[model samples]
Each structure stands twice: as C-alpha cells, then as structure tokens.
Target: MGSEKDVLVAAAVFLFALISHSEGIVGGREAAAHSRPYMASIQVPEGENMKHECGGFVIADQWVMTAVHCMPTGPNGRKVVLGVHSLSEAEETKQTFDILELHNHPDFRESNYDNDIALIKLDRPYTTSVAIRPVEFMRQGGTNPGNDAEVETAGWGSLDNLGSRPDKLQEVTVDVVISALCRRSDYFGSKFTANMICAQRVCPQPCDQLYKKQDTCDGDSGGPLLFNGTVVGITSNGGRKCGQLKKPGIYTIISHYTRWIDGILGLQPDPTPEHSD
Candidate 1:
C-alpha cells in the first residue's frame, strides 16, 4: 500500500509538468551550446495535480527554476526529479523526486498572470550525467535576443491545439516577431510591455484552422524560450485559442528582467551595455 501511494504521487508530479507545456508561448531560434540545461520534473500533490503543471530548470546543483503556476498550492510536500530527457509515462528514463522549498517571485501576481517566475530548492543536489547537466543563465549581464531570431521550445503539450496530449517532450522551432507587431494586435492589448516579447509564424498567408498547429497550446507555459542557446523569455500566456493569427504568442521578456532575476538568484548584473543600434 505504501508503494502504491508512492507511485500515485509520482504520476501526479509528471501530470503537472505535462500541463505546464499545455499553455502556449512563441518563437523559435537556433541554440548555441554554452552550458547544461536541466528540466524540473515536479512531484505533484494529490488533488492539486489537476490544477498545476510541472516546471523546473537547473540553476544550481540544488536549485531548480520554474513558474508560480506550477505550484497550484503552497510549496509543501512537492518534489523535483533532477535528470531526465523524457517525461513520458511509457518512457524508461523518467524518475521521481521531492521538492525542498519553493521560492516564488515576491511580486508574483496571480490576478493577471504577471511576474510568474519561481524557484525550487531541491532537498538534495542531483547527481549529474551526460544527459542531465546544469543550464547557464544570463546572470544579469547577457545581451538581449534579437527580434528576428529563431528559438526552439520543448514541452509535453498536445501535438496540436485541442488534440491528444503528448507524453514526451515535443520540440518546435519558431521565429521571434517584433514587439510592435505583437503589441499592436487587438488581442494583446496595451499591457504588452518591454517586459514581454512575442513570436509567431513568419508566413504571409493565414494558417489552416483545423490543422493550424504552429502555435503553442494549453501546456507550454513556464518552459524555456531559447535563442542563441541563451534563455530569452519565459513561456507565459496568449489569447484564448491556440495558433490564432493577430493573436501571436507572448512571453516574459528575459532581457527586461535581468536585474530582477539577478537579484533573486544573487548574481551580479552584466557590465556591458546592450545596443539596439
């Protein structure tokens, strides 16, 4: 009975992570190899599993980064599995672990979905292997990503909006759309700020509705938006339906919050200036 309960707890954690990828975001960019990136496999609480989505990334051996939404309830009794490539139930690589502490952004606001970042302190440092290494951050001094850059997003969300959910990580490439285009949309509203960046299809024509599968959907939120192998944005939110045009994907612009991230992570900001020129 005790073992069965443990297995149930493990399933909840995986399910939450799967849901995080369900929420959509934008863009695709080429990644440069700089450091190791780790995905957080959160151990879900019993009933809250239905509300939360798993989120985690390695910043330190004992620390994982994620979104506030990933913890539907307070941080007690959660866990994080440090190293794994696939989160699929059928996959042989998945492992289960526990969370030590959840340090959510102090200014995190749930009302409008702003300031959604959070950090998870693991109960113990994860042992590293070839498949699982630590990921490097801008650490307050990295350059901003380009608007036209290509980025890659990986998650376990559904293959297409309103379709069957995926059990394994699904990676897709997207191009960053200029902020002006993203903000000007009637759907995004004036709330779109420098703190946010947007991405969408580079097509001159509209996509098919039934098969309009290029955009992020219900579970991709809180995932990494990588450009040039640097973390550029946090997968946040978008309009109601996925892949709808003039309603492009939106993200928490990483460059705009470097200081905040640095402050939280206790890292020094970059000394160099970023130029639009």
Candidate 2:
C-alpha cells in the first residue's frame, strides 16, 4: 500500500492502489470457476458530468451495497443500475436509478481499507429481472460456514492477468482456506482483523501447476462472497498481484458488521420483505 494521501487519492478516483511489489498472476483458468453469482453493479461518479467507475449491487429494494473504497466522501453524484448484465446501458433491460442517499460505514478509513463497506439508497425501486434482483441473505441464526468451505464469487472484473475488463459479468467457484493459514498469509498477517475473512484454493498435494490461478484481483472488489447460498462476506482486498501464493483474498466479514448494517437499514434481525429468496 502507498501513503495515506496516495491511497485516498486513488480511492477517490476509483483507481486500484497499484502499489509496488505487484506482479502477474497465473494464466488460463480463473480461480473462481464455480463461485456464486454476483448481485450488484454500481457505477460511481468520477471527474465530470455523469461519468463513473466503481461497481455496486442492490441489497434491498432501496439499498445498494458496495465497497467503501469505491466512493469516498465527495460531492460526486453516484448513480446505480440494477438488473444490469453488461456495462453498456443498451444491453440492460432495467432502468437506472438515482442514488438518493449514500452511507459509508461511519468507521470506514480509506488509508488502511478498514470498515470497507457502504450502502446507497436508490431513488426508485427497479423492476427485478433475471440479471438483477436483491440477493437474499442467510436467514438470521442461519448456518455459518466452516473451514475449507465451498464457495462461489462473481464479478465484472479482468478476465486474464493482463487483459482488459470484461464486457459482461462472470462467475466462478473457489474454496475457503483455513482462517489461520489465511491470517498468516502475506496479504493479511499484521493487517488482518476480525472484520476480514479469507478464501483461496486448496490444491491436492501433487497438484498441477494450473491450480495456481485461483484468486481475485482489482475490479472484483465490492463483489459478494457467497457460501451455501448466502453472502458471508464482501470482496475487499488481497495481494497486489492477481494470484500470489501465500497471499489469500480478503473479504469484509458480513456477520461481524450485521448490527451496523441493520442499524443503518433500520431492520430487525430478520429483515423480511427484502430477504426473500
């Protein structure tokens, strides 16, 4: 990571903090070939009129959730589009909605990426479509995942190590690694906190070199981390490289922030109507 000033600026501009010591990831297959599908796609405002960069998703009829880094406190007008499959507006069947309110986690800090979560209220409820719908959260007192759990991830990020952004959304499957191993990884270690969860692949002892490509990079941030049909975490950060060994992907643990989110959303433990499958 860079200095606080540089990290803040890059976050404000919706650019990845491509700090030094970064390198290329393994080529060919993606690490998340069987992960769950993503539910949100938000376009954040940038320099001038109506332009945006960051992506987000609608977590409720009126609320869209995403990474806090995508939008720092600013005067920018961030708009969101639900039911969108492609970045192109014409390809989307649902109409775009204005962001009536923006709420970054009160404790969010761009410098260190702590409390990297935010929620936006849409001006209008979009018509749900196959491409878009409010993803249901695991019911209250629901099942929690164990070590090495099977999970899926989806996003509209870069497809290859050196490739440009994907035109359409993509989905993949990956496995959760032991939290202890993940915490000890270079990506977390000193910076790891109870708010973050780690996920990665567990290759067989005599694995082929192809298993090396299982990880997330930039652009995949703010996406969902689903396990057993429920979102357990939200993509936050990882190693600067695309897929570096001993450096697992870090996500904001959703359960840890449930009360904070509920306080913001003003809901009970089981916020129904918005959480139906």
Candidate 3:
C-alpha cells in the first residue's frame, strides 16, 4: 500500500491528467435535439475568447444549478446557453443569458471538493416551451434510487480520452454505484462524502476489465445527473483517465443540499411534481 502522501500525489496526478485531457462526456452517444431542454452550457471569458467551461441545468425561470468548482472564485463574464444541441451552430430555439448572481455553497472547498455545488441567477427569465424548460430536482426525503438504478447524464464534453470536445450534445447511461462500494475505491476511498454521489458504467461478465468506457469528462463538470427524469446530481469530477475501470465519476448530490439550494433560490423545497418530457 502506498503512504498517504503517495496517495495524495496519485490523486493530484489523476485530477491534473483528466483536467488537461478532455472536458466532455466520454463514451456517450449524440442526444436528440432538445431532448434535454434544461441543459445549459456555462461559458467563461478567457482573454479574447469565450470558452465553454462547464455544464448546468435550469432549475427555475431564472436560475441554473451546477458545480461550484466550475466557477471556483466567481463568475467572469459568465453566460449560459440553453435549448441548443450544437455548440457551434446557432439554433432558433437557443437562448443565451448573462449571469446576474453567483451563489456557491458556503462550505465549498477546493480541497477534497466538499459541497461542490452552485447556483447562478440569470439576468432574465426564459420563456418556457418544449425546447426550453427547467428540470425538477429530487424532492426532499426522496430516497437514493439505489445501486441498480440506471441514470442518464448529458453534456457537450469530450467523447473520448483524447480531449476532443464534441459540438453536439451527448448523453450516456450510467449505473449508480452504492456509496459503500464507491467509498472502497482506491481513487476516492474515504474522501467520499454524503454530499457526493458516485456512478459508473455497468459491466458484463468479467466485469473488472469491462467496467470502464463510459463517464463524465473534464468539460462535463456541472452537468446534470438525471434519475427518474429528475435532476439528482451535478457532475463534479472523475478519475485521471476517462471511464477508468474501478474509478467512477463523482457528482454533487443535489438532494442532500435542498435547504441550501432553497435558500439560494429564495424558495421552499416543495414536493417534486410530475414532469412531462
């Protein structure tokens, strides 16, 4: 076994490699246009360019939820694009909004990525329609769907480990890894917290070697982890290599922070309503 320092070094290396390689979904297929209406692409100004830094989902008329790490310090001319499938081409249904306010979890820390969630207030509200809609969050007291649950994650991140960011949105099915099993992994181990959720691809026979090949990559950070048609988690991070066997992607468990989220949105946590696709 490696010493704690060695483990930390390995973890740091893993994070750095993933961050440098790609920023999108790996092993996911192209999604149907406007299939995920709430999907939002968070863009940050980088010098003279506006780069897509992370993904998010509209939770309300003028609010978006994403990972706190996506904007560690604060928003910098950050804007969100919604109702679009392709990033390069403009769709008539697409709408862009400037960020008015940014609210990160008070306990968020770069170290260990605790409470890695944030909410952004849009400069204006979007007109709800078939192509632009908000997603419902997992209501309070909602049970964790369990390990066997098949969840869908969507993003415009990379399609592989080569750092190739996709122009079209991607969606993939992932299995929820039981917290206990997830906590036992060498990559995350005890670092797993209640605020975090783990997910990975389901493997067939000889699972060990086949477990890899599907995951959220670098550019996917702050995307939605959907279960039962509801937003259950927010993409946070993953292991060094995209979809590395035994290493699962981590997400900010949205249900665990209902109070904080409600506070930020200035609304009470109401029971989740039945939503139509």
lDDT of 2 by residue, 1-277 (tens): 6899998887866644331111122222322321222355666555554433555656777787788887776426657765655565465364677778778888876655778888887787777665656766544456657777877666766654674566455655667777777666454665777667777664568877544466666677888878866787777887776666677777776665666678788876444332210
- By lDDT, highest first, what's the ranking? 3, 2, 1
Looking at model 3, residue 43 earns an lDDT score of 91
lDDT of the structure predicted as candidate 1: 0.60
- lDDT of all the models against the reference? 0.60, 0.64, 0.83
Which ranking of candidates, highest TM-score first?
Answer: 3, 2, 1
Question: Could you tell me which 10 consecutive residues in candidate 2 have the lowest summed lDDT?
Answer: 19-28
Q: Tell me which of candidates 2 and 3 scores higher on lDDT.
A: 3
Clashing pairs counted in every model: 29, 15, 5
Candidate 2 stretches with Cα past 4 Å from truth are 1-38, 45-52, 138-140, 185-187, 202-204, 210-212, 269-277
Point to the candidate with the largest TM-score: 3
**What is the per-residue lDDT of model 1 for residues 104-127, given as tens digits with 9 covering 90 to 100?**
767665664566677776667666
Candidate 3: residue 142 Cα off by (Å): 1.0
1-277 in candidate 3: lDDT tens per residue? 8899999999999998765343337766778899899999999888886778799999998999999899988887888988878888868898889989999888886877878889999999988878889999885688766876899899987777778888888888899888887678566877787778889884576766523377888799999999989889999987887787777889888877777777777887555542211
lDDT of model 1 at residue 231?
68
Candidate 3 stretches greater than 4 Å from native: 1-24, 46-49, 206-212, 269-277
